[model samples]
Target: MVRLEKDLLGEREVPATVYYGIHTMRALENFPLTEYKVSPVLIKAIALIKKTAAEVNFELGYLTKEKGQAIAQAADEILNGQWQDQFVVDALQGGAGTSTNMNVNEVLANRAIELLGGQKGNYSLVHPLNDVNMHQSTNDVYPTALRIAAIWLLKPLSEGCAALQEALQAKEAAFAGVIKVGRTEMQDAVPIMLGQEFSAYAGAIARDRWRLHKVEERLRQAALGGTAIGTGINANKKYIFMVNDRVRQYAGIGLARAENMIDVIQNADVFVEVSGLLKALAVNLGKISHDLRLLSSGPRAGLRELRLPERQAGSSIMPGKVNPIIPEAVNQTAFHIMASDMAITMAAQSGQLELNAFMPLIAHHLLGSLKILTNAVHILDEFCVQGLTADEEHCRNLLENSQVSVTALVPHIGYDLASKVARRASEENITIRAAALALAVLPAEKLDAILDPRAMTRPGIAGTPK
Candidate 1:
């Protein structure tokens, strides 16, 4: 290990292993790994983080071209793919992203140092803090990274919504002409096409996509140069624009500085708002999942208009049983996202003056919720919706068995007679069609035409023969 002098700030002495690509080791030694690591989104957000810091460092007259090229090259590699597989770090520990920010600097600097034909730990040639970090502090960098990470992570959310929309569209088209019972309070009330239910589900996902897109607009505002407080202080004026420009370029995004540093640095309500959007998305997912679970309950005893993919054995004792496991996963993810939103709200409220020290928890829970919901959406799309089946016979049987068909007799035999028919059908366990025939509520041919599920599915038709 090459020996290095202590920092001019008179902080702890630099370790040699940190200079040699041992980012994890240095992170553990310098900042406690704790339970939470950095978020993958934040890790990816480093391109913006480094771009902002590098320009500022260069403007501060501390960075040389040779070191700059090295850092830039390493950053490019990270942006491309080299470090994509290592983001499973716990997100529950560390304050101010000390461990995470330093990990990026150390790893990138080591890789850049190697590219410069210099041995690792040879700050004599390139220094992670002095050259790579320059005029930046973890305070400014962490929040900036979080914003970029949230933007990066929104991709999956968008795609998940699209997939759900497609699923609903497909189901809508497939069941367009298939009629079924529409229920209110679990009792038959009217008629609607199975396609109408799927269309509603599809419409819900489209609305969710819109909400997420709106939330992302607010999330794009980041505090890049607030630097330890609401003031840029020692940072150069042009450095902010340059870093933000480069970060946007690298991230393929439209990131911008906060309009007001005082408000941005002091308040984390934007994060809370974004978290709430995620919770809203989770609620949508839970609603759709619950609907699917209800629609696919059983082949024999329950409403079986639809069928989910049989992922695992649903019952321990029953044979050939299948359950809506994908929907269940979606349900759990929704709960987690809601809880994460609460954490974000609390953290945003916990700020004292200009900084929220509880940001670590906010980032941790929000990122976790994003990842969990992302995977859940994908799983539901791939392993469940893609494989769903419709029970044609069961749907027809339910429609035929419902007593709501007695309403067709209202205009023919009058309301009082229709009520008698419905009550008699319910009491005798006979279908409304059978009771109508026994009571001579309407001619058999007229009853058959008017009580048809397809005829009832049309609007403005009160189950009367036309």
Candidate 2:
């Protein structure tokens, strides 16, 4: 079944059973880029805006009550997850998301026509542009919807970060007494408790979670009511003033209309700022994952100080080989997020005057980064960080073998003597403590006092490391 629809360009045939109409049909034929569809969260955000606009227009006497009710109902159905497959426009499209906006507009209009006992493509009954998309433009509506969708995704990412932080903090507490050698530039440097190392991860994740929440405030400013080029062209002043508040009320979000709508619509720096924060998170997660991989390298030959949960086999032919698969997965996810940040940065920088034509690119990378980072954090918490076990005996053996722990006595025995002891131990194939004893650098009791894990892991080493 085909229905005839006409636009300024000409006429096209649309499937009669589909809610989406001619604009979407044209877009489907035009854009055959990435197969990814528009994000459902973004679609829902647009529906929230449409429903709010309909109710506001009806109450303001711009729309007839029946058409308004029918349009609102259609939007509500979309909001409730109906007709999702009808939004067939490629996420990567031209016209600065006009195709996506028109896609939504057409679907809602056709569905509303059905509700009002009119057939699809009956513009006289419920016009897609005249009634459903009244007082909105792709310039204003797309960016506003992007912000709402970004905020909604950010909440879960923040929560996922919080969960990761808590998991790391738990490890910090669990391993507070587990002694280990710290490294700098991939070389053993000094003594540190496992807890202190985990504490650093916890601190970084805590900051990431807080930053995600703070960045949400930046996304709260919406370009809605700004219309085409931010001058609210062809839209009534009453609608311009009332629409944002209604959107906020209906969406239960703290979205506020920008004071300088023109500037807001023109500038794409907000996405760059948000992407920078997400990149920061990626950096930290990458660092932590790298550390996990290093520490859990081998049960027999590698550092073997920290043990990750037994997951999959490391090789197809290897026997009883358990790899740090979860952290490896997290590392890949962080890498992708970092690359996404770069893409988002470039797209944001490429914005021209009046509007950014690269928003689809930014939206794809930004939203994708948010979702993948959230999943990475959650998996790191549940699958890796929580199941981590410290190889205390292995840690102790490494600490005993490395001369780095000798640096703890530099305050009393001096650096020159410590170096001599380290060299003597290396040359003689003996422990630093034994070399120190043979050199008579200090009494055995005094050497043991400084070498104690508690004393070695703290500042101003001495009794109880206070």
Candidate 3:
């Protein structure tokens, strides 16, 4: 069945059963970009804003008690996960998310009217703009809702980071005693405990989680009372003062009103700052993944100091081949996140005058990066970091063969003799210990004690070289 709905652009027949109205219908027609619909979390954030506005308006005697009650009930239903499919507009629409804000207002209005025993589109009794959107503009409400949605979304990403950090720390403890040759510029530089490398990864993830948690401080300050352009034109002074408090109560988040509404409305630097933190996380994850790939490069020919879990058959034609698919997937996810950060940077800079017209793109990229990184962190923990196994024998062998092990003998035999020992090891293709003993650089017992890889990983002057 079809019902006619009119707007300034004219009337269109919308599906009778849908809660969304003509504004949403026009947006659907205008932005046929993809099958991507608005985020359900974003929709719920908008509904919470609408419900709070209704309560404030009713308390100020601008709305009837019955109208406000019905609107609040309808918003509660939306928050409890109903009528999600009725939000049909694309997420990437233009006009700074007016289409999205209007979509929420219309849906809440129609549903509230139905609850009040009136048919949908009966705006005379329970109007979408007149009652539900009282004192609200897309400029104020949309950015406010986006902030709430981002705070809501960051919880999962923070949890994912914590999980990944725990997994890496477990690996760190598991490999604490295994000594390996540490490389600089692809050459052996010194001996180090394998645990130290994993500890570094864990530290990076811990910092990322801390940054994610700190970001809420900036996101909590919103431009909700700014009306159309921070002037609070048509809204009541009481409503402006009380709305954010009510919103914080309804949403159960620490949302604060912006002290300077004009600056909040005109600038998107907070989002840029948040995206920069996300990019730093992506860079860390990418570096960790790359290091994992190199550490697990080969079983026979490359630096196979660690064994990654064999996830699947790695080749279409070759047999008995297992690849580091999990780390590879994480690498790709980080790349996507970095690119999304670039998009967010451009969108933030595109703001002009009183408001940014590029909010839809900003919303799309920011939320998308968060979602992907959350999943990436979870999979990296489950498929890669948790199941890592260090090749202890390989680590010992590499440490023994490394010419850089002569670095330990520098204090006893002097750097000049240590340099000659290293040169002889490389020239004669022998172990550093063998070259030192052949050159009589130190006594055999003294050389063994000084060149001990495990002792080298720690402190204390190599036991005075026996």
> Distance from true position, residue 157, model 1, in Å?
2.0
Please give the CA lDDT of all the candidate structures.
0.75, 0.89, 0.90
Query: Candidate 1's residue-wise lDDT over 289-408, tens digit each?
Result: 998899888667879899888888989998888878899889988988988888789888988887777777888887788788889888878888878878877777788778766665
Q: Tell me each candidate's TM-score.
A: 0.86, 0.97, 0.95
C-alpha lDDT (0 to 100) for residue 277 of candidate 3: 92
Candidate 1, residue 393: how far the Cα is off, in Å: 1.5
User: Which run of 10 residues does model 1 get worst, by summed lDDT?
Assistant: 2-11
**What CA RMSD would candidate 3 show?**
1.8
What's the candidate order when arranged by decreasing TM-score? 2, 3, 1
TM-score of candidate 1 versus the correct structure, residues matched by position: 0.86
Q: What is every candidate's alpha-carbon RMSD to the true fold?
A: 3.6, 1.4, 1.8
Q: For this target, which candidate reaches the highest TM-score against the unseen true structure?
A: 2
As for TM-score, the candidate ahead, 1 or 2, is 2
Q: Please list all clashing residue pairs in model 3, or write none if there are none.
A: none
lDDT of the structure predicted as candidate 3: 0.90
Q: How do the candidates rank by lDDT, highest first?
A: 3, 2, 1
What is the lDDT for 322 in model 1? 81
Q: Which lDDT value does model 1 have at 185?
A: 87
- lDDT (tens digit, per residue) of candidate 2 on 1-466: 8989999999998888998888999899999999999988888889889988998899999999999999999999998999999988888888888999999999999999999999999999999999989988989998999999999999999999998999999999999988889999999888889999999999999999999999999998887888888987877888877889888878777999899899888788999999999999999999999999999987788899998988777878988888888988988998898898998888888889898998888888888888888899888999999999999988888887888868776787898998899899999999888999999999999888877765767667653345
